[model samples]
Target: MAKNTVIGFLGSTLDASKRDSSRWQKWRPTIGLCMQQDLRVDRLILLHGEKHESLARFITQDIASVSPETSVEPHRINFDDAWDFEEVYTELLDFAQGFPFDPEHEDYLVHITTGTHVAQICLFLLTEARFIPGKLLQTQPRRGQPDPSGSWNAIDLDLSRYDSIAQRFAASSRESTSFLKGGIETRNAAFNTIIDEIEQVATRSSAPLLLMGPTGAGKSLLARRIYELKAEKHQLSGPFVEVNCATLKGDNAMSALFGHRKGAFTGAVADRAGLLRSADGGMLFLDEIGELGLDEQAMILRAIEEKRFLPMGSDKEASSKFQLIAGTNLNLIDAVASGAFRDDLFARLNLWTFHLPGLADRKEDIEPNIDYELERYAAAEDTRVTFNKEARERYLAFATGPNAIWSGNFRDLSASITRMATLSPDGRIDRKTVDMEVARLQRLWTSDRGDDDDTQLSAILGAERLTRIDPFDRAQLSEVVKVCRHSASLSAAGRDLFAVSRQSRSSTNDADRLRKYLMKFGLSFDEVRAR
Candidate 1:
């Protein structure tokens, strides 16, 4: 087969004075560079802001004047007119679909102007929709004064890194739902831990595995990462199939998983291989497993247990040895108790359950995650952007502060970082940007925390106060708690908490403080030790 490539260009518009013209000049050259590197530039879709039609015409004319060989088409959709995310994404997806690329032969190049939130979201959705391969190019203004001649300013970008960026975005988006705020830090541990476990299970587990976690804890990422890891580790020879249980309600769930023959149902026009069959000898990830109907759950249970399932209207049983990874946020034990989920099925799944800790639980990871996000955004913008030290400190403080209970976890973080990165000038994020985000988060937290009564509020406040005390006192209390919990003797507790090998004057004072503090809190030394 001949090596053919398709290039896609998506940007707001060149006419917008707010956009750096020097940055805009980089597009054609970047495309030209890619072409020189053996990448064929086929379709260019120009996404515009307000005054889309005129801007599109101007850009098209500009490209024609510069390079008569290149054909650029304007996808005339005004982002300003977009009332909702769905509308913007849909328009972008439709335009992207129009790119004339033979998927069988050509690789795609997707270029965006400065990682805008709309652009980022559209890119993520496009990947999820599977319209085009996940790829992106970021163009930035080149340093130095413009040439005295009418030549366009220079811009630098790396074309080859698109695929890698897309993969990272896909992985992050998959794990977005699992974290309070989606970003490199929040998803890192969850992604790494899940990938490790999935690999182990794929190679070692005989029975089907169940992934249990709260909503947005990244079950889907885990599932996909598992598939990739397993494919590499076990040399699996089949495709990874994913089915969202929430989308496949009623009898459609059965047909989607276990394909039906022609005339099996109202829409069954032809025979099709079910996801299970397609995933044979590979992996099938069932997302939102709790949403499946009882009958569907029964069918899934049988398939998992017997490795065989009959399609609707077909008596013949189809055999599939696909590894099952079912994901759900529901309390499966409660579901079983309530008879919503089968006890036997729950038992089978419980054996391999892995709970993902929410973002609030991993406070230490927030700063590192933010740093990672800034770097990603900077790279995508083709700029050397860094967070102001004050902004970084403020963000870390907010993340670890009482206000951070990001229910959406990593997804929220991803959105926030993307916004900050796009809006910041030359990628210099400031405290105001951080303040806006913090205020938004605080409002959300306030609304949620309002559900709790005074008693709960007081208890939480007390805990927060304790956490803010001096490091020495905190360390002493922690040591006392640890010794009390593990050591069998009082001498051990005194020695460990006070760092004294034997009881002494200084040790007694330390013990007294510990005792007094415990009493102040209406607890005995034993209770304080118990922690």
Candidate 2:
């Protein structure tokens, strides 16, 4: 491998008048670099202006006297004004780009010690960005003693090995993930990983995020949380404006999202700043974006790409600089194929798409979410509710069981908790409350099945047996069958079912009694078990 080359601008310290017999009195940075025994500076590219030509020549000779092996090459660059950051940065960038670099054979070092602060910062940025594949070299002046030769150090700008920095990043990642989760301790590893990546993206990116999932799967909730995280991080300043695109109708959709001039439509009585404008410098969450009309889709495309759009009935364009987070339950790719959604808009938002899992898919998270829901209810109702140990377990068993059909995902869970908390006597949900809740959930799941043969009822009693059951007794029997399906055996189900009723009986034959009852419904252990 070839030795590294040092590049830096010549300072006034290289001038003959600034030179001294005692090197410690005024040790210039450039001289310090050449005198370093361990540094292998094969070639030095000294940048100089018209007035610094003499100084550059003197430095070259001085460097030769100190370190003869290092080759010095002076390059003159004109600057309209060195103090102007824009001019200096542009000139330096152009120079670095034009320079012939043999990356495989040579390494590069940018000496940041011998330039104006602006120039130093530009060089650091260039090196850090890898525009110039180099490390930054800094020279620290010695304060005391016989050695003012000073100390030289190189920085690569990558601090991956620093434990504090790594820990900080890990902590921030956890915090961001928690923010997106609404502080719920989500147990789904895949969902947590996705949230972690989203947090990282929210922290560093302004690109459009497309959250695709079924309704009630927390897409809207996660989008709002992302906006809040960005705001808290100081990445965004304006309000988080949200709009359900599915609710937007007719010409109002355009006016609501892209603003409208007065008289744009019959109902457009006044000029309006749309959701996009209101979200300026912040985040705009357009939920159910797949519901937008084609014209609105095209307008959204323009707004996302150009950050400008023409308002309805307006001749001029309006600008709104906002980060966008779009949500939808519809498959945009399918919609695009069907000519219902714009292909271009889908492509743009597809850059960072995350699919939130439904409640059924994340059963492990139900326990924590149950607590979260209860806490939310307490906050809203100003009454804390606690579930008895067995009540909580009973609820979780049914919730995470195969019989549960959470069509409404989190919405259903939240509603369930709200109802239980509202009705809990003395703020305590007992076994009776849990039983009622379970029965209600079963009814809901059964109703949601909508005459399907593969429903929880059919799965327990078999489709043929369900057809013979009376409509009046179907709801009551369905709950019984659900318990039977969850039990380890028919005897276990009978004992639990007749725990109170058996006390009225002179003799207890719970299993035999339950078998005879199931026989009345034309169902048997063999048939229900097969189902």
Q: Estimate the TM-score of every prediction.
A: 0.48, 0.81
TM-score of 2: 0.81
**Sliding window of 10 residues with minimal summed lDDT for model 2:** 461-470
- lDDT value for candidate 1? 0.62
Count clashing residue pairs per candidate: 16, 0
lDDT of all predictions:
0.62, 0.84
Q: Which residues of candidate 2, in runs, are more than 4 Å off?
A: 1-4, 13-16, 19-24, 36-43, 84-87, 94-108, 144-148, 452-531
What tens digits encode model 2's per-residue C-alpha lDDT throughout 125-148? 989888898788888667775553
> Among these predicted structures, which one has the highest TM-score?
2
RMSD of each: 22.1, 8.7
The 10 consecutive residues of candidate 1 with the worst lDDT sum are 147-156
Error of 2 at 375 (Å): 2.5
